[model samples]
Target: MSLRTKFMLALLFTGLAAVAMVGGLAYAGMTKKVDSLRRERAAEHFHASVTAYLAQYGSWEANRGKQGFDAFMRSRGPLAGDRPPPPDDERRPPPPGAGRPEPRGEPPYHFILADQEYRVLLGAGVYKHGELLPEAARKNAQAVEVNGRVVAYVSPEGVITPSRQELQYLAAMRDALWFGVAGAAVLALVLGVLLSRGLGRTLGHLTGAVRAMHGGSLLQRVPVESKDEVAELAAAFNAMSEKLARTHEELNASHQTILTQAEQMRELSVRDALTKLHNRRHFDEQACTLFSHAVRHKRPLSMVIGDIDFFKKINDQFSHATGDAVLRQVGEILRSHMRLSDLVARYGGEEFVIAFPETELPQAAALCDKLRAMIEAFPWHQVHPELKVTMSMGVYADLAAGTAEAMLQKADALLYRAKETGRNRVCFAA
Candidate 1:
């Protein structure tokens, strides 16, 4: 099932298939060759028998009188009626011109007399007597001549023929084929099993390593015991796994860095440059969320909008550096008095905004009054020793407010009114 096992099985099967195919073809070819050789030998034997029989017949026909030819022809069996008699028979002292006695009913002898040229002469066989030869016997038959006369004859019984030799060779080939196939099959099976076992063991180790990797054990590796390809594959796999683990760690670190940078960017976008407090942009975004929560959860929310009194006069009298220090001090004081849940932002130059969740307008106004009194009492000249600062504060509370914008507008209106009435005072939105 594992890669190594699969590979081994693939190789085993491929070898088996190739061997089987080639072995089968070899067996077939060998069978054909052996059969051909056997057929050739059988043909030789048949030709030898036929030749020997013809020589004896020819000698007897030439030397013996008509009696010998008659006896030989009779012993050999029938022939066609058109065959001429032997020369010895032809020279017989027959009644002058008695016209060769009506040849005995289709003479027992069948001979084909040769022409003066002594080439192949007429021939006959049992076939002419209406006796059909077997395929093997027919193939064994050959034309011969007796005393320069042609004859057709077949080998005696038990003589080898092409078909018989072919059958014998085929039988031997079948036996050999079965033996080779069985031996190959056994060998293949044994090799396949042994290879499968080795492969299975290797794959088992790889599988275990993979499972460990899945379980967060990145250091796990497959065991390698050889210098084969599987070992190389294991090494490569381990390298890849290590690389992936390192890459994953790097990606995680990068993700954390991005998150940190994003948080820092958010802070930078919303903080006042001099005061280091939430600027107007942050106030707008947070105020909307706070307002929604107050409306949905029925929680009181309050806002305090304040402006530094005579801030431009202070900057003009001293310097921008002094003005900046004053703003920084005010931001510090505000932050010190606020709880973690409260938000304080520098709304604009010399203006600050404060938000309180679950605080009523009266509580927010009282806190602003406290902040005003503290600023008035504190010695700003300790650091500058020459500057004095005051702020006008306005407070508003959520009453299921028309909108966050409307609430901020109301608070801003109060802040302006406080500044108009006096430079340092706290006002509340009715």
Candidate 2:
């Protein structure tokens, strides 16, 4: 069951138990009080009957055989609910001085009368007329006397039965107690339900906030609607959500910064600082990969290694800055003639390398010639009024130079041959 139901049940049970206990105790106490009062009344009646009998008859012997005892008993009211017993041996008269027997079953409460010698005369509560009283019963006997001589003893037995009013009072008390208990239980149940609902509503807000946060809404917050502990918890949760949101933003910013730095580091590692072309290390790595793929796939692959002709003369005659400008231009010319599948790198000072995938020796030689012409036609006079520049290139294609270093070395040898033959020309191995 839900907490609300459990709480209501608990309160109801407690109220019922308390009420039941109190009712039981109250009933017991009232029963005892009523019983005491009844016993006192029965004892009083016993004493009054004995005194009147003694005043009229003088003694049990004086009143015998004349119906004096029967007359006296009949004169008294009923002893509890017992009626007088039938005359003893009605067909025969009592011997000159005998008294009538007291009845049996005296309504659960009556008096027993006996002479001073403890010879019982009238029995009470199911006792025979002449039966000797037990010590337990005799213990409560009261002696009646005249002229300093004990005449008779009266013993009360079960004389504490409650009267009608007393019984009704006890019953009413029980009913009232039970009614109050039921009322208290109902009240407790109502109060418990109210308390549980109040708690449930407060906790619901926090629960909703938590669910939202689980769904990736880190900014979700609970509202503090009261000054109770639940409201305090909501306030704490909102604060925590805000902290989480801020932390998420800070982490995202840090991640972006790290990515930018990583990209810059990667570019610096592979690119030449001056010409902005792929450096020698990047060329070696890429060349090996392309060469292996081409050989394995039986595809055409070519290499063109070029050198700036009279590069040292340009630097010596004018300035190194002019030579650097010319080198930058050379990189631009190589890029212009290259496709996306080609790799171009500054191999070293005044030397450049280019690799072309899916290209034959003849096709590479034609591209290299184009590049040489472009460099020769560029306005090198911008750096110096008289400075001019050109490049010689060599092409090697479809050769099984197993490694990148081997392929580059073979192409460099071809470039040396082209420069020796003439400047500003392209040469290729068939």
Candidate 3:
């Protein structure tokens, strides 16, 4: 079950058990006390009736019979079957103890009656008429007095019969008990709802926070609305979440720093130190991939090898610093003119290599010729009085050469032929 439901049920059962225990005990104790009081009042009233009867008649001689007061009791009691007809104006006087209301049923407790001489007058289904009351039984008998003279005695315990008044009181007490139960139940339900809702609200916030953290948001806050244990737990959870988020951020920053350093190291490994272009190692790897792609897709591919003409002589005639300037300028020019798809790298000292994907021999050779002319027209006289500079490039575009290494070798042969044929020119495999 949900947390709210479990909490509500726990409260509801607790309230009910408490109310039931207390209410049931109260109702039972009240029932016992009420019965005791009813029985006592009945005994006292009966005693008073007997005393008045003797006072009017002056003896047991004038009762239902001189046979005994049992005669009078049998006459007025339940076994009489039917009551006598209404008295006429000339009717005889009413019988003894006839002043009581009609009995709805059996009396709550039957009684034993005796004269002042301790002679049993009524047995109450326990003793016979005119029997001397036992000494042991006489202890429980209450004296019936008339004008300060004891006339008879009455016993308080015998048959149990609930009269109308007793039943009415008991029923009222029962109703009150039921009402108490119902009220307690309703109170429990209301309390359960109220308390559980408050608790559920706190739990809902915790649940939502956890879910958000599960998603990409690592930081969250929840309300601390109370000082109860639940509130303390929420506070603890908030602390833990904040710490976790902070730890995650730290880990991410460290990871990013490591990745950046690794990337820089990788770049340095494959880059030429002086020219800032890809070195031969990086070029060979990319050239192999480009050659494979061109051969696999049956697409045009081109390879070119270019050399700075008379580069060693320039270094010998002037200083190598001037030659370094020329090489940097030429590498920059190649880098600036190349498309994103082209790969240009300094192959070795004063030499360069280029690979062009998706380019035919004609387009490759024309591009190489343009680069040669640009290098020839550069103002090299600034380096020395007679200084001059130029480049020779050989273009080879044919995947039939089978590998990037083989194609570059063919371009190198063409580059040699270009240097032999002319100093500042581009030669192609035409």
Candidate 4:
């Protein structure tokens, strides 16, 4: 069952048990009181009957009445003929002066009578003739002495047993008590069911919100209806969820920013600062990878190493700033003239290198001569009209040159030879 139903059942049962216990206790107390009253009335009737019987009759008649009393006792019938027995010693025949035996069986009326010494004389029902009476019956029973004999007596005022009317009344009361308990229990059940349903609905809303959050929707919230504790709990939970959603968004933004910065840093690390080209470090790495590929594929590879002729003299005549400008201009020219597949880099101050994949030694030399002629024909004197610059180029082609460094050294040697012969010219290795 749902939580609401279970809670209602528990509350209803508790109310029912409580009402039943209270009704049972009340009924028991009332029944005891009524039974006590009935016993008291019976005692009073017994004492009165005995007293009246002794007062009207002489000794002989009284003796005769005793026989009647005995016969009544022996009859063992209903209340009509019931009587108390004579004393054990007095069970014998009466003395000569005693009167006729008492009428047989119990008298039509109830009475009690005691003699001078408080010994029983005559009695019926709950009281003995001469016995000391209980406190309940003493007030109503009359005290007397007949012929020097003391007696206490009472007459029956009403029936001393529980009447049919009283029984019916008690039975009705018991039924009413049960009915009241049942009615109260049903009312409690209804109230409990309503309360529990409200509580369960509140909990269900909270549960649905939690499930939505788990499914990646952090914006869900529980509904609040009352100003009770459940409403307060829902408010707190909504606040916490809002905080978590905001924190998640911030973390994601931060992570994306970090990733973008890392990419920029990687690009900066591989690029030359002045020339805006791959630096010597990056070129060396590429050259090694390319050389391995060329060896594996058995493809021709060629390289060019070039240097500005009399570069130190130009720097001394002008200034380092002009020398740097010259190098930057030359880097731009080389980049523009080179094919897309070729790699170019500033090797050092006034020195540069280029890689040409799938090119023979003759083709590499021709390309180097074209680049030399292009650099020599450029109008350098326009910016510094008194200055002139020239470059010497060397070409090398061989995959089995042992290493990229070895191939570059060979190219460098050829470039030194070209400078020795004349600046602004290309030279090829034997």
Candidate 5:
């Protein structure tokens, strides 16, 4: 297929995929919401029915008697029946404490009445009245109680199928989904064709510009009248053509100047602008090289991760300018304390990392402690009389540690431990 056709097909596919994903997620969320609403309503109904019944008869003990059971059966009518009703004993209610058999067989609703011990007193299921429900089924089931004690459960069996209103809602949603899919399909086709035509025209302009440039026309430029991606490309091409013409004119005089600018840009790329310290990118590059050398030579090497404590509080209480000043001071201290063989960098924010070559864990720990003490003792009166700054440090040193990444991670974890235990401390592991 042509490039335009392919691009159009890709756009169509992406649009359709997005629609399907959104529709599926929306449908799932709606389904969950509907199910939750149904359960909530069912629970409300169950509670109301139990409350009204108990109110009429007084307590569970009163309901356990023959009069109560008969009254309950009559109230529930044939729906609550599990077997032929026992012949009534009008002489006296079954001796007090004697239990009534639970109902059995499937009914429109399943209700169970159990005692304090969870033994079923009456149930509306096929199980025997006294049988225990499986633990899995009882999870999240609602309870009924008497005198501030749980005495029964009313579990509705089967999925609470959608009611008529919910079914209508689902049907409407399905219709909307179908309509959306149809609309998306048409939209995709129209957008695909338009984009293909536009891209084709833009690419044709680019091709002609390249041909003119190849024929030694350095001043040739692509017209850029819009802010679309194609226009951006055209603007970039025009700039390049202009640069080429200028370069051809001053190739001898500007060569050294260009090299100096390139070097400055490279330095800027790897240095933190605020603190004038080597940034994380530079740190990673240096760390990999140093770690490899240490490993190959079987020399001890230690890594340290440090963070300024209460740095955020300082920023909140003082201005951000003060925070930046503090960071610059900290960076100066770190750089001064480091030897030519060691590396230090502003990892990010108030955090910094240092790598020590030919040094063991104990030596690194000692150095970090010294640095922490120095930072703590620095006269913050220079900035604010009451200001106090401290740092937590963690060091890891193991020549056999397979990767630099592993050592860095260990040091980070140790730094977290130091922070958790108390601020302004140094912790180390070998």
Candidate 6:
């Protein structure tokens, strides 16, 4: 069942059990007490009457058998309900709520009168007249004394009929007990609903938040509506969720930073530090890919290796700073002049390499010669009056060279031939 229902049931059962046990015990004890009081009153009244009868008649011998005693008992009103009330002049009005007059019926209490020798004179239906009373009954007999001497003993032992007021009292207690049980049940239900609403609401919020977090939204909050342990639990859960969300955010930010740094590190690994050009290793790896594609498709691919003429002497004479500037400018020029499909990189000191896909040998030679002219024509006077720069380039276009590495070697050999021919020139084999 629901939490509220379960709580209500538990509380209700507990209340009912408590009320039942206590009420039952009280009723039983009160019943026993009332029965004892009734028997005491009956015994006292009977004892006095018996003592008066004996005192007036002088002894048990005055009344031989039950016939004389019955006559005496009839005069004295032996049965309470059997006699009419005494004349108004002689009788006082009974107290209110004490009880109504007893109905004419068998009396609940029976008294057996015994003399000092323990012979029964009045059995009240339990023994024959003049019979010896039982030992067990004799133990409970109360002494009836008249004029400072023991007269007789009477034992009052029988079912006790409760008075109307007594019945009313017991009934009132029983009704109150039932009322208390009902009241307890109502209180339990009310408390169950009130308590369960707060607890269930908080738990519902927590469940929803956990599901949302599982779905990738890491942030959540729940209400803390009480100071009880359940509320503390909710508060703890909220704190834990907040911490988890914060931790997840931090982790994501760290992950992004790591990715950015990794990209920068990878770019640095493949780039020439001075000119920011593709280094020989990156170029070589890419050139192999390009060569594979060209050979597979039987497409045009041109390879070129270029060297700055007398680069050592220029660095030696113009200072290495100027040589670096020259190299930076040349790399930028080549990068700008090439198609997006072309690959270019600084091969080593004062040397550059290029790969032109979808380009024939003649077109490659023309582009290289143009590069040579541009280098020779640049404003050398700006660096130093005596400084001059030129470049020699060699181009080769042949898939028969096998791997890109072998093709690059052929281009290098051609580059040596160009330098052998003269500085500031382009050479190719068609």
The lDDT per prediction is: 0.71, 0.80, 0.83, 0.74, 0.78, 0.83
In model 6, the Cα lDDT at residue 268 comes to 98
C-alpha-based local distance difference test score of model 3:
0.83
Q: Pick the candidate with the highest TM-score.
A: 1
RMSD of 5: 37.1
What's the TM-score of each model vs. the native?
Answer: 0.69, 0.68, 0.68, 0.54, 0.42, 0.64
**How would you encode candidate 5's per-residue C-alpha lDDT over 1-430 as one tens digit per residue?**
7778888889888888888888878888898997777766655555555655665676556767435654664555332212333445533465668886454321223345555455665555445567886665476456776567565665654335455567788888888877887788889999998877878777777888889878977776777757898889988988998999888768745877888999999999999998888999999998999999998888889999999998999999987888998999999999998999999999999999999999988889999999999999999879987788999999999856678778989999999999999889998988
List model 6 lDDT by residue over 181-244, tens digit each.
7887788778877777787788788889899999998878888988999889889988998999
TM-score computed on alpha carbons, candidate 5: 0.42
Candidate 3 local lDDT, 1-430, one digit each (tens): 9999998878778877887788789888987886676667667656765776687778877754434444443444432112333434645555897885553333345678888998988777888889999988899999988889888888875665665565777788778777877887788889989989889999999999999999978888889999999999999999998999999999999999999999999999998888889999999999999999998899999999999999999899888988888888889889999999999999999989999999999999999998888877878787567878899988998788889999999999999999999778888893
- Distance (Å) between predicted and true CA of 86, model 5? 99
Residue pairs with clashing backbones, model 5: 102-122
The global Cα lDDT (0 to 1) of model 1 is 0.71
- Output the lDDT of residue 183, model 5: 85
Give the 10-residue window scoring lowest on summed lDDT in candidate 1: 108-117
lDDT tens per residue, model 1, 1-430? 6655565557667766776787779878886685455545544443443455457755424635335544544444333212344554555566987776654422422332222233222224323223444455544445455566555443332322234344666677677767766676677667767767766777788888899888987766677767888788888888988888888889889999999999999889988878889989889999889898999899899988989999999899988888888899999999899999999999889999999998887888889999999987779988577778889988888555577778888889998889788769999975
Compared with the true structure, the alpha-carbon lDDT of candidate 2 equals 0.80
